[model samples]
Target: MKVVFFGRTSNGKSSVINAMLCDKVLPSGIGHTTNCFLRVEGTDGNESFLLTEGSEERKSIKTVNQLAHALHQDELLDAGSLVCVMWPKAKCALLRDDLVLVDSPGIDVTTELDSWIDKFCLDADVFVLVANSESTLMQTEKFFFHKVNERLSSPNIFILNNRWDASASEPEYMEEVRRQHMDRCSSFLVDELGVVDRAQASDRIFFVSAKEVLQARIQKAQGMPEAGGALAEGFQARMFEFQNFERRFEECISQSAVKTKFEQHTVRAKQISEALRLIMDSVHVATQEQRIHCMETREDRQDRMEFIDKQLDLLSMDCKAKIKKITEEVERQVSNAMAEEIRRLYVLVYKNELHRHIEEGLGRNMSERCSAGITNALQNTQTEMNEGLKPLLPAPVREQVDKLVPRQCFSLSYDLACDKLCSDFQEDIGFHFSMGWTMLVNRFLGPKNTRRALMGYNDQVPRPLALTPVSTSMPPFPQGSMTQEELMVSMVTGLASLTSRTSMGIIVVGGVIWKAVGWRLIALSVGMYGLMYVYERLTWTTKAKERAFKRQFVEYASEKLQLIVSYTGSNCSHQVQQELAGSFAGLCQQVDVTRQNLEEEISDMNNKIELLDTLQSKAKLLRNKAGWLDSELNMFTQQYLHQGR
Candidate 1:
């Protein structure tokens, strides 16, 4: 039977072992701590201690202090190290060949200590959890025991609440405190750790002062008075509980050998056999259900894919038709909307008596009014166009597109198309109005002063009369009359003056008209055949201007409608395609996962079913051996108890 002591730092785990041995064979103190695990057992003939560090040769030591020093030495102690102390049966009766005591270092000190404990302490027949009673079970203590309870094979756990002497001064308060600690530790072990039940755990709890016991034993060994000192008094007070614990621990260890190990192996083997059978059955059922589900999902996915494909096909076929229809609808709505907007803009422009501003210098007022009108028209058209297009799109597609295409999305699209149309119309109106306004201004203001003279402003100033010869001056004529030569020169000079004046007027007045409409007219003339040219030039009137306006409006509307159709159709189609692609990909991945999982589960179930027969045979063998051992141990227990009675 192997008993292991586990606790945190400075909790007197070494002291507890010393009390049990009734000898100072193990080091015990805060400064003289057990850094490594110390495994002590009784030797019948020779007493010896050996320290083993991994693959290194065992180093023999003669005394307990030397063993402690060697364990504490950094160079000597390697990973997974331990000190084995062998002593004569005279020193300690409990340290027999069959029973060994392992004193472990504080659990909170190092991480490697846990691995060390797990390596050597798994098959322990009994566990002594030496917890500090001055406080409740700490985090380290709970954690250490929680871990120990998992790996330990034995169920006989003894919880020693060490340092119980601290509470001796106040008996009533100490009892209350002890009760609280018991309740808390039990809760931790039972509820938190799930290692033991409340009733069984409460019985295993032993309150004793390990330090007092150690001191009492040491003084008694030194031939001093046993009951005189404070240590002896405390030890006497707590000795009964400690002795009771010892008796139970011994009884548990004796039972642990044949009944515990054999019965556990027997039960565990049977459980494995039963558990494997259940698992195989469950896996068979689950795999079959999963395979059926996969088939159903595959059919469902096919149906869904076909439906989606059909929808996409129909959408593609009707794509152009839908675009045309939607374009017409949008154009009609926008036209109606713009008509109202244009009328509103006209009303606003004409408001406050526009004819009044015309009289207030047409150049200045017309410039300001035209600029203000264009701005107002632009703003109002944008608002009206957006409102018109807003209802054209269904909410779902619109919302999706809104995220994809930012920057006022629908409004920006509507505005771009509407603005293009507005710009075309504005250009026609501006061109015609500028020509008409310039003509009207020049006619009213008399061709402007800049064009009235050829060279300078002093052109009308009279020059000094030129002197002539006596022969030419003989005849004094009337101021208005002239001879044959003078008459001819006067007529020729008047004709040249009239021609120059007419040419200057034509150049200034026809500037814009000649550049625009007049050039087109010239082109038509040059291109037309003989009689057709003459007829077109004669028939080309302002009626053609009306035709031009009608043509410009149609072209502008058509261009804008096509642009709106192209952009919106592409965006809507892309959004639909993306949504379909994502959904299709996800469904494909899910189907793959489901099918793969079902296959793997079926394969695993088939493999485990083959191992069931072997497990059954093993379980039968374990049960037979365990039964024979149990009977033998029962006879021994009866004999021992009867003799004691």
Candidate 2:
């Protein structure tokens, strides 16, 4: 805490601080002695040093006279500059208790009163106005505190009527002068400033001779007797009054420092703790609510997961059964359609155009008709199966499942190469005795028998071959077929086999015919064979050979279609099942991710709640401690006041 002294020039402001320290720590003279602000504070060790403003250099001051000389020489510094004097705490009781005394330049000598107050007086606990007893309070002195009052709230002020010892020369007017000084000072503080009441203002005002007090204290410190002098009249009374003033000043400074500095800190600390506790309580409530919300969401997700799991189980079983039933229905429809298409195969093969190969034309026509029939049957089955499975998917996943299975369950590219099937029919109407033994053997064995020998055939009819009439179970849908990978493999394998067969046939026929006949014989054989082919062509339309060719082609087509019936139906069913399962799994994965996020949020909220709990406890303890300190300070003030009384 700091106590700052302010007054006009030659009013003993420095002498007052010196008397308070019981030493001439500051320079005092007949005129302005303190040119700059001097701050005297206590230090721990016995070392006393002077530090000039804006300089770190320490000047040791051991003797009182040396201290005075040092301050006098410091007159070169501006009045606004500050110099700090560090004296041992053991030299003064007030300084030992953390009191600092600031001796400022006389207010009358400086126009920067506002600057001075802002620089030094803002933090000062008590302000001492050392006025001369020979005069009324100067306007300069009052204006300084007016500026201070403007900055601080109800600043603590004490008015000292210094040089009161001169009143001894006029003992006749002593009481009158004292009463007048007291009334005017009290009126200025209570009426003009409104800082205190009349009674408190009277207590804050004092009339004492700082020079007398300083001389007496110096004599006492040196253990010397009171100096005998003619101006010693009323010396004892003046000393007593000075001692009384010291006691009041000490009590006032102590209580003022506590109220201004320590009490303010205590009150602020209490407010901060209360505010923190309230904030922590609010956070704790919010966190608890959030945790509850997270838990509820997690539970809802768990229930959803359970429902989805049940739905998946039911969907799996229902889909399997539906697919099996659909497959059987598709197989029956395709078989009937195929049988009809095979019966009409003769229409394509028996054409007399001969512009292109008969085998190729028949193969192309048969593939188109049979593929269309099978595609229609499979498409109808797909539409029915998709309609059946639509209700099985949960509402949340229905749109995604539709996108996955878009048009149909699978693709059907039924490329029936009729040449491979119908090539068994041989043109045997012409005489073959001149041809060769090979021709004779081929005719006796017959085209059907020869076909069986060249290409393997399973004549055993497929089971469950009975054709059921098409049912209007569901509306027809657009056809889809095998995946690209499966289709590519099938096409590639078929082309490779056909290429190998063509190459081998070319090589065998060219090599054997060339070896069998010379060039002239080959030409003669070709001429005779052409004449016979024309004759055979006319007989190719005979009823017997037509029936035989048609019957053989039908048998081959029917057998191949039977195999396709089972494969196409079962493959489409499996594809539908896979599409449904994949969509369902994706939906389940999304639900699991949401549930995991909720769990993490709940855990974070729990940790935050715990942290808030700890903070609240700490704030509570801090608030309690501040309250205890405030109470203790109040108790100490009351006891100190009682003792003074």
Candidate 3:
């Protein structure tokens, strides 16, 4: 961890550092002196880098040319040389342990160096934006404050009120002056940066004269000068822990001096971590609406499949024309855009030729392979989208089918030749990353909607439905802890740094002796100072170099993780969609068969009942016929008897 210090041009950062170091390791007393950033560490010797040509390399100081805007990004041609600023290494201290405190180049009222210094400040773990007690929040201070606050959710922001000394004989004047200054500072911070609500602004802003404080501590320990008990009292309590200070007295005072230096550096690390956690928590809340929204899934849409594919085909063709336009523009601009590289015709031609080969020949050779990289990237993206939708699914289906995504997938590319070619159709320009095309073929193609979604952050969530592809051929940044083996490698690297600094210190000392001005004692002191300077410089440089390399390591790791997450999100989404479709089809089939069976059974039962009724009716008719015949015979007998009488 590193503790980086920044302030306005003439504030007292160098003075404060020297106070901690207990010696004027860094020469300070002029206008905007330390131009380029220099990393300092505790060491046993002195070394310095001189300004002129015929310059001899000394221990303790490194003076490189001011870093241009060119090297702001990770990739740079002179990155190796810039990484070499380190000094004054220490171990077994609370504040500055393995700490690289960057004394950034200060920006006055000028904007010339503002952007450059801004970059340096951004790189620090904690930002200590120094404000003077006199007219504390100046225009430049306000600007830097806003810039840092906007860009960084910082952990520790320290405002040091430098050069405050009150002689008791003039108590009234000093008290009034101090009170006014403190009140003004409080209001500025509260109104501008919002600090007053927490506590007293004066308490937060420590009033310390660096020169006086350093002198007080050294004299108090050595018994050379009277301790300004009043001044020393406040400085001791707030800036450093009393226990650590006392512990120093137990050890040899000289070693305690070094320990205090390192302790200050370490404190910033813990402060940064604390402040970051607070801000993250403030924004980290998962909203009820978000929870509801996040779980929501798009309806299981099927009809759009054919429609979408056809639309995409047309879009892809339209994309090709746009891509062709861009490629032509790119080709035209290539002469100017790549002019520097054009000097090396072979390398330039090689890259151009390779890109062309990939597009014209290899691209068509195996379409699957050509698009495989992107297809893989899309699947991973789909997984992320699925995750965001996970909570929104129905409870029953939520657990089982929540992660599903449509599997009909394709890859396409988009290209823009130049600005004018793209300006008219700017909306389409962001659509695809086209490799190249012939005069006739503008090449553009990719996965439709998912490409656009991955452009922002939070698009890479690890849910099954998350949709974002790892675009760009470059590798991603790494995250998480380093392996023990890797850590061991770093320790080895650190040991190497320690050795180099020690050796550098020795050479610087020897050089000072060789160029002795007068007495042997003076020469030796100069030699020793040179040695210490070199050692510190070496230590700081090695640390910076290590950090630069670590960045590369991190990116590589992240790329690998991105691929994994995207794949999981895609596969999960597809599986859920497929299962849902299958279930619906099965239910429809079941309902149709049941309906057919019921109709057949009703027809059979009706026919049987009608047949039984007909038989019963026939029986009744037969009985009635028998009765009629009997009645007719009886009537005929009665009529014959009446005539005989």
Query: RMSDs, each prediction?
Result: 27.7, 16.7, 63.9
Candidate 3 to truth, TM: 0.31
For model 1, residues 187-258, the per-residue Cα lDDT tens digits are 876787665687767767888887777777778889987554765335566877788888878777776765
Clashes of each: 0, 6, 82
Candidate 3 on 542-621: residue-level lDDT in tens? 45554534443333323332333333333433433343334323322332333343334334434433443443344334
TM-score for each model: 0.41, 0.63, 0.31
Worst 10 residues of 2 by lDDT: 353-362
Local lDDT at 568 for model 1: 42
Which 10 residues in a row give candidate 1 its minimum summed lDDT? 407-416
RMSD of 1: 27.7
lDDT of 2 by residue, 175-245 (tens): 99999999989988988888888878867888888887788888888887545333357777777777887
The best-first sequence of candidates by TM-score reads 2, 1, 3
Superposed by TM-score, candidate 2 places the C-alpha of residue 617 at a distance from the truth, in angstroms, of 8.8
Query: What TM-score would candidate 2 get against the native?
Result: 0.63
lDDT of 3 at 295: 27
- Mark the regions of model 2 whose C-alpha exceeds 4 Å error after superposition: 30-32, 51-76, 143-155, 170-172, 190-202, 226-231, 270-322, 339-410, 413-645
The per-model lDDT (C-alpha) reads 0.59, 0.68, 0.43
